[model samples]
Target: MENHDAAALLEQAAQLDAGDPLARYRGLFIGTDTALSYLDGNSLGRPLKRTQRDISTFIGEGWGGWLIRGWDEEWLDLPQTIGDQLGRAVLGAAPGQTVIADSTTVVLYKLIRAALATVSDPARTEIVLDTDNFPTDRYLVEGIAREEGLTLRWIEADPASGVTVEQVRHATGPATAVVLLSHVAYRSGFLADLPGITEVAHSAGALVVWDLCHSAGSVELDLDGANVDFAAGCTYKYLNGGPGSPAFAYVNRRHLSGLKQPIWGWMGRKDAFEMAAGYEPAPGIRSFLSGTPAIFGMLAMRGTLDLIEEAGMAAIREKSLKLTAFAVQLFEAWLEPAGVELASPRDPELRGSHITLDHPAFRNVTAALWEQDVIPDFRAPHGIRVGLSPLSTSFAELFRGMAAIRDQLRR
Candidate 1:
């Protein structure tokens, strides 16, 4: 942890990279350059090299050739197909409980509305949310609360440590209808106790909805094992899905029977071609779908999910812990003395794949780093998010990125 030892950080990084089992996986991405250090994979993951072939094939063979017929044979089933793959490979969920469609905001809106319907009690009209949740999530919850006349119970969590199980327990009560929280804090990379928090919400007769935007592919999630009621996440991050790719939603089988999503479209109707006048919801998870699947948006995810299936989430998670921990160690040694503060949890068990460092000069530093092609996102109030994707990021890349930050600060 000493600066003298830290001076050899680059050499240490090379040694770590040489032994990393997942090291070769980094070459599979589109960008494996030695000069460019992409530190924002938690925000947007690098595309898989296989994705280029997949997209080309889709354009020529899948879309160009099949056209309308593709709808029935393949395109129509993409939502459920990819959803099942994601559920099995990454979510630890069984089939029929997950589906991919719409953006994260839309999916979250539908799931939240569906969850609200399940709670028939007029008195249970409060929605509990953390203050530091993603802006879109907070906005969606705020809009829903205003329209439904529900109260918002805000849990003010530390930006560094995030919302703890104890904080969640204190936030929910008899009046709590639903608790919306992010599995990993977006700004600080704080990993919440999913199973523990879910139990506490259920104990108070409230259903919990998790936003897996930051945790989906980065963390090892067991939705079924955790007995999570509902969840939504974007595929563009750790899943390596392309920008603006459609998000996924999961509903428990128990809730699927009676869950009534607000959006009632032809896709969710039992029979679409029949053109029935009356509205009848489709059976099971299909009801969660209200529009045509984002076939093009989902194309890249197929390749990424294939890689995830090959590597296994257990191994991916193991690497994520080491990568982030190494970043912390490097931060403590190099950046800490350069007036950089560790904004993320020190304990790797309590954190996600990324680490945050805070300094007053980071606003301009991040801008300058971007020009130098060392990309790490800057959050307000001086936090720089160092997003490390396990499959795509290497220790040498992490060291170079951190060293660049250190060098920039000294100037």
Candidate 2:
């Protein structure tokens, strides 16, 4: 709030940026050279320099040259091949369990249906869900329950925090067929306990489906270790995939054969080209595919996944913690005094790679901030979500963005 305080914080940011081992990665992005303080990487990540070259190469050598033979050669299995890479680099899943296909909503729908189908008991007719989940997750479940004559058991979650293991335990019972939840809260950046929740759901004889939009690349996941039933996420965020990139779905290998997702398509048949009479699902993860792969959308994320593999998820998570922590420090020193309230968790362990700050004035302040080239997304009811992507976001960039927020709040 004061000049001296601002000066001190600026110096601290400079020191952190200077010492940041991941700092060099900022150069790989397209728009980092400008004065823009891109504080929205949690929403959509910046494109990589390699993405352009990769797309070009695909056009020239892979798609442009190979023609439709591309399907026979590689495109037929592109989803699983890249899905395997994504699993190895980010999802903590083994091969044959993850597939890249469809929009996140479509994938979520398929997985949720599949999970519900696995429950044969006539008494298990309710779906357990949370209040604070993303709109799509809630909407999809609501529609599915309506169509299937299933009841919805809602978990009331605090916007400041997230669903606790205790809440999940209380929410599940004999009636619960499946429990759907977000690994990280979309509004608050609160990280949920995956293993604990999954264990609880299993005890209740319910399958678990995790929404990983905010969890995929920001946090280290152990879907296999947790014995998770199903998971899906968008690649556009910390995974740095371009806009509208295909989402990925992970089904526990144990469920590969028995689980039958509701949607069926020609591509998912045992032999896609067979044009067979009755549909026999493809073996393993490939059965999840409902249509042709989005070759262009998948290209950008490959570069980021390569970077994630090279840097390792552990180091990325460590940097993420530091980045979010540093953003909290700035929020306290500058924004809090300007009447900005921290909407996310105070404890780093409970948080993800981003934090939200709320103020009555933020709705309009967001427009002013964006005009100044300090772009953080505005959530409903006056919340500014500051998403810090560890690879492309610098401490100094965060400081600049926070300073701009403080200035706008003051204005």
Candidate 3:
């Protein structure tokens, strides 16, 4: 595709976007006065109008009126409430299995340690995780291994292709205590075969903990159907929870009864307010809680989850594939010939809601795009990530951003 030809195709994409069913959702976000073409929704989604209002109400009514009594009003139950909504809406898990608290890193640490403790055999002293898993996940796992004197088996995955079920099978053995992986590759946006990988880990007598930061709100997950052991994710991405919103963790119903959290804080005690003489874990997933909940962050997540439930995960995923396909098509036509390579998968089914492109000048190009109010993120070793949230991103915005990149490259 020549530069001129690519420009023409982008123009055509704009025309097609006008009739898209999800087009109107673009208006629901808080747009900037500048020409900000935000393609980084995978990192941090644009705040919804409803979220702003909810935050106001929370501060004014929930905190001011209820005061410390807010605990009795509904603050304590918000975690489970939002968790149930996230489960029914996206996680595909039963109630009492999901709770919203802490960040993704904290949740990962808690779950990984708990999982490792469960497999207490001396031979099971190894943790299996992909090299391509998010940096935070890898770091957390490494820290756990160091603390527990366990071996870290890093599965070196193809940077662009992501981790596979075959690779996971090869890496897992009798010594594998826990298998940690991300549902979607953060750099390549490749969606892992969750069910297949989970089956492989279980076959090796190991538990699996999935980082759903990229997949929770953007993809349709059947954690219950898949019999996944544990999971964690953030609300700030496609979930449209505000930045720094609370994260969620999930333990399978069957595992919830037996699993013991390593961080046994007061909240996880059977009678939290009893100020008990000894620690007695509460029944089910509540045992995972460590400290006081972030009420404001939880409220923000509640507002976002409400929107997700209303829209439905199936619907969100359907439009997500379409949006990513549209961006991939645009990239193939426009950037391929300009020394830009598609870093993400070409197959729609294997990809997530983002399309990544690789170029030698990606760092500079990304900085230039930001100056022009086109917001796409730069990953390490020359990769530019364009994250399109299906609920909020429009075809026009995608085309505009890609066109800007093309224009900048030509100069």
For model 3, residues 138-251, the per-residue Cα lDDT tens digits are 899888888889899989988887999999999999899999999999999999999999999999999999999999889999999999999999999988777798899999
Candidate 2 RMSD to the real structure: 1.0
How much is 383 displaced in model 3, in angstroms?
1.1
The count of residue-pair clashes in candidate 3 stands at: 0
Sorted on lDDT, best first, the list reads 2, 1, 3
When 2 and 3 are scored with lDDT, the better candidate is 2
Look at candidate 3 and tell me the lDDT of residue 258.
79
C-alpha TM-score for every candidate? 0.98, 0.98, 0.96
The C-alpha local distance difference test score for the whole of candidate 2 amounts to 0.92
| lDDT digits (tens) for residues 1-411 of candidate 1 | 556686677788988899898887888898796589999999898988899988899899988989889998888778888999999999999999999989999999999999999998889999999989999999999999999888999999888879988988999999999999999999999999999999999999999999999999989999999999999999999998889999999998889999899999988888877889988998889888888888989999988888889998899999999999899988888888777899899899999999999999999999999999899999998999999999999998898898889888878
User: Which ranges of candidate 1 are over 4 A from the true structure?
Assistant: 1-7
Question: What 10-residue stretch in candidate 1 is worst by lDDT?
Answer: 1-10
**Candidate 2 per-residue C-alpha lDDT over 220-322 given as tens digits, one digit per residue, 9 for 90 to 100:** 9999999999999999999888889999999999999897988888888898887879989998888888777888888899899999998889988999999
Off by over 4 Å in 3: 1-11, 32-34
Model 1 C-alpha lDDT versus the unseen true structure = 0.92
Give residue 81's error in model 3 in angstroms. 0.6
Q: What local distance difference test score does each model get?
A: 0.92, 0.92, 0.86
Could you give the candidate ranking by TM-score, starting with the highest? 2, 1, 3
